[model samples]
Target: MNMKHVFNSNPLRYTAVLGLFAILLAISCTSEKEPLPDECEGSISLQTTIGSEANCGQSTGSFTVVATGGSAPYTYALNGGTAQSSASFDNLAAGSYTLTVTDNSGCTAEISVNIANQDGVNASISGTTASDCDTPNGSISVSATDGAGPYQYKLNDNAFQSGNTFDGLAPGNYTVTVRDANNCEVSLQATIKSDVVFAQVKNIIQTNCAVSGCHNGTTFPDLRVDNNIVAQASRIKARTGAKTMPPSSSGRSLSDDEIAEIACWVNDGASLN
Candidate 1:
């Protein structure tokens, strides 16, 4: 008998052969499904290092972030900002922030951080008062502590200077500002005083001009009163400089030294101090 005729004639044997072919096809299909990559299999992890605090009114704070255990080539973002390849961020003010890291396989990890503020610049100012009204011989010095060092000093809207001491300052109120290397600053009020010239001017007036007949309370420009002397400063400077005051013919003329003293007082802003 022929083999093909024998197989077709056996119905149970034909069904069994068909079932074997179906089992082999299912195994082949299952083998085609690929396994996940080893790199992208694990969970992502994050680590961070908190940075130094910022100074007053400055954005000098910074922090760093590192990621691992997910995939290679990660990106970092701060507070949901644009992603960057670098793990570090800088020039930040004191505040709270959220840092996020992402891997090549889109796996993400995050953490929260806080940047603090440093103590502001601390300073103490001291100075010498002017010796004479005609001279700007006063000086001021500042000693500062805290914050960054190598400090700069400024006096009353002037340019900043590296030196701690400022000379040739006039007698008056002054604003002293001190700034550190980090640009943290503090301000203080100072005063330079001159009692010598003010007293001399008063004495000269009282002994000569402010007497009975000259500039006493009855005179046209009463030099006896402090207010009147201030008001007539310009005239006093002019007349004394020209040697025309105390009237040479009156036999009570002022000496050259006295005239110069009055002129210096008048030129020095005619202040009572």
Candidate 2:
């Protein structure tokens, strides 16, 4: 069978053969297309730097993130919150958190971080009362624990010092603050009482100038008695102010502060009350 003689003999059959060939060619051209490879494969990565821990009972912690390997202009989201262009997050409390970074190509990476505290600075304060009238012999001491050291101490509005003991404080209410090396601080209150000036002066007189050979029964006015000391209050203030009391032979003399205290009592009317 010759194919050319057969087709020439049947024109309809030749037209049908051409139609089938055209259909087959059209089907081959319309087949499904193959998918292209992903543009961000194995290229999306994230790095982070943790910030300082939160202060005790405060939310001051933070962190920063840097993205690499993907496209530029990355955005960040913390704990699934709204995304932002800034790479840093702040005012966070002590706890665990998840951060996500997304690049311009829609590639994403995630990391976990934690914020913590350095422990609270704890403190206790103690004080001693002024032993004499209108004097500043009072003292305060502070004991600190926890947090970092060596610590610093201060009283009220005074400047900070390395020593925990504050001496020569006047009798009154006071505030003491203790601070650690990390700058964490705690405060407390203390008080010193005012001693009875009349009693204090009588004791000073009896112990120093009212001995058997001095202002006892043998001496005029006999200052061994409290009434006698009160009666001679003005003369006593004058002599003590001149630093001539108790006599150099008696091996005794009143301190400037003690003399001032006696003068203060006399100026205030020298009442036993």
Candidate models: Cα lDDT each:
0.70, 0.72
Error of 1 at 107 (Å): 74
Residue-by-residue lDDT tens digits, candidate 1, 75-166: 98887789999988999765456788888887777787655557766667655556455567888787777778888989879999999888
lDDT of 1 at 264: 65
Q: For residues 213-259, write the lDDT of model 2, one tens digit per residue.
A: 56776556577877778777878788888877766656788887788
How many clashing pairs in candidate 2?
Answer: 0
**Candidate 1, after superposition: displacement of residue 137 in Å?**
1.7
Which regions in candidate 1 have their CA more than 4 angstroms from the true location? 1-55, 58-118, 195-198, 214-273
TM-score (all chains, Cα) for each model: 0.39, 0.32
Question: What does the lDDT read for residue 205 in candidate 1?
Answer: 63
